[model samples]
Target: MASTTTVPALKADRPLLGIAFMLAAGLLFTLLDTAVKWLTQSYSPVQVVWARYAGHMLVLGGYLLILGWPRCREIMASVESLPGQFVRGLLLLAASTFAFLAFRELPLLQVYVINFSSPLLVTLLAIPLLSERVTAARGIAVAVGFVGVVIAVGPVDWRAQPAALLPFGMALCFALYQLATRRFGRNDHPLASLFYAGLAGALVSSLVVPFFWSPVALGDTPLFLLVGTLGAISQLGLIMAMRCAPASLVSPFLYLQIVWATVSGYLVFGDVPLLETYLGAVLIIGAGIFLATRKR
Candidate 1:
């Protein structure tokens, strides 16, 4: 077998820095998702999502103002693929909406376990969309991941727990979102992509929120703003991490979110995953890591 190792474009000495940033980003993402889950108890998913994007826009807008509009305009004009950028933003919006709904409807741990399936989904999708070769190890990994999902989900009495569909849908949308990010996000500036995505989300959700709008209670505003800030920070950190390291190295760290989700769910909501859930999560995360690390 040929060695598939390639020299990393980034400095070897800086791997720790990349890893640290990625871990921090993962933690922030977990916190963002957890906050959405918490707010869901008192607010509709639409309302929670709207608040998230609204806060994100306000923060980014302030940052842009500080940098000056002309600089922002120059940054925007530097992009060659506005249509691709817009599509990526649209996919992100859909993924966020579905994920918020999942958090609202399911336990945070369950929602994250399902969302973690995105890496596996990305692997499978890459075969066709990315023309990446899928080796036997990857095939086995995919099979094992699916089995883990079954074990995690356990005796899907879908008729009884129709809400289960929401997480699964969130997973699918998120997978698609990641794929879009890989495809369209390369040419775009990370900050620009973040700004556009937040703007797109805010505009789309704002239009939808009127139909489902309930007046925001006084106490929830802080939580809402925190969620958005966390969301933006997490995404920006993720982009920086990916730029610094290969996906195979960085992707495994995402499983850390599962740990955070489980602990947070227990601490916050007194929710515990069943034994099967733990087994499934272990299988899925393990298989994903194995597949991601396998020599090409």
Candidate 2:
């Protein structure tokens, strides 16, 4: 979403620092995805999603406690749109669910290349969902972005690897989530929104996870904790980046995750992306950056 917290902004001259944070955030998220993919091989995707949100809640809960009860209450009071938060949060959970499912069946490079189309989805969705006007440039970019998606999904057997489409579903969910944030986050503090998101994910995942629960080996417990911690830190990095620079300057760096995912996928999983994936990723990245830099 590239949303900044309503906190102190960095000096205008320091956009580089924000760019750095964006790069780091990209790497963290890639690492998080890699971790989730590994965990899903052994546990049900639902169970992995539960551990993710549950751990995030525990981490966020502890941070709130450290902030003191009164400050916590003040943060809670900052929410002007509770239902919007819930809707956005659940949408994210759905995206996360799709992420695990997609990763289980697709290569990391493939999943991320498709995921990059999310900004284009957001642009198309904004017209009806947020009632924002989309310029022709954006509309064309959206079209090109989908073209990139088609290229990325080239020649896949639907019957054999239907999960390949999961990333597209994830992108749609994320597009809706971003719209919800834009619509509802005007009056809500970024931290406040983050809290509500974690809360909603934690509460819901807790209730449903039991039915899909799998026993955790003591050694694998660290992986579960890592998923939660990485999610929190990755989000914090985004907050920091947006605080330090304009979205136009930093949002482009988010694509660097594609590079990181490629390298990580090769080194960690010995998976190499196809030539078509590279071609499609360039189109998707170009389209996303064009949309990001536009004044609209």
What is each predicted model's overall lDDT from 0 to 1?
Answer: 0.73, 0.76
The regions of model 2 sitting more than 4 angstroms off are 1-24, 237-253
Candidate 2: what lDDT? 0.76
| Candidate 1 ranges beyond 4 A from true positions | 1-22, 242-249
Estimate, for each residue in 1-296, the C-alpha lDDT of model 1 and write its tens digit.
01132322433424445566678987998899888998888888888888888888888888889989889997777555576566766777787888888788788888777777776776777566545567887778778988887788788777987877777777776666555554555446677877877777888889989888877778987898898788788877766665554444455567678789888999998998999988998888788678645766
Model 1 C-alpha lDDT versus the unseen true structure? 0.73
Q: Output the TM-score of candidate 1.
A: 0.88
lDDT of 2 by residue, 1-296 (tens): 33323322333535677678778988998999999989988898889888888888888888989999999888889887688778878887888889988888788988887787776666666666655666788778778878887897688787887787899889788666656665665456667877777777888888898898989999999999999988777766765665565444455567667789989899989997888888887887787677666756
Question: How many steric overlaps are in each model, in order?
Answer: 0, 0
Instruction: Return the top candidate by TM-score.
Output: 1
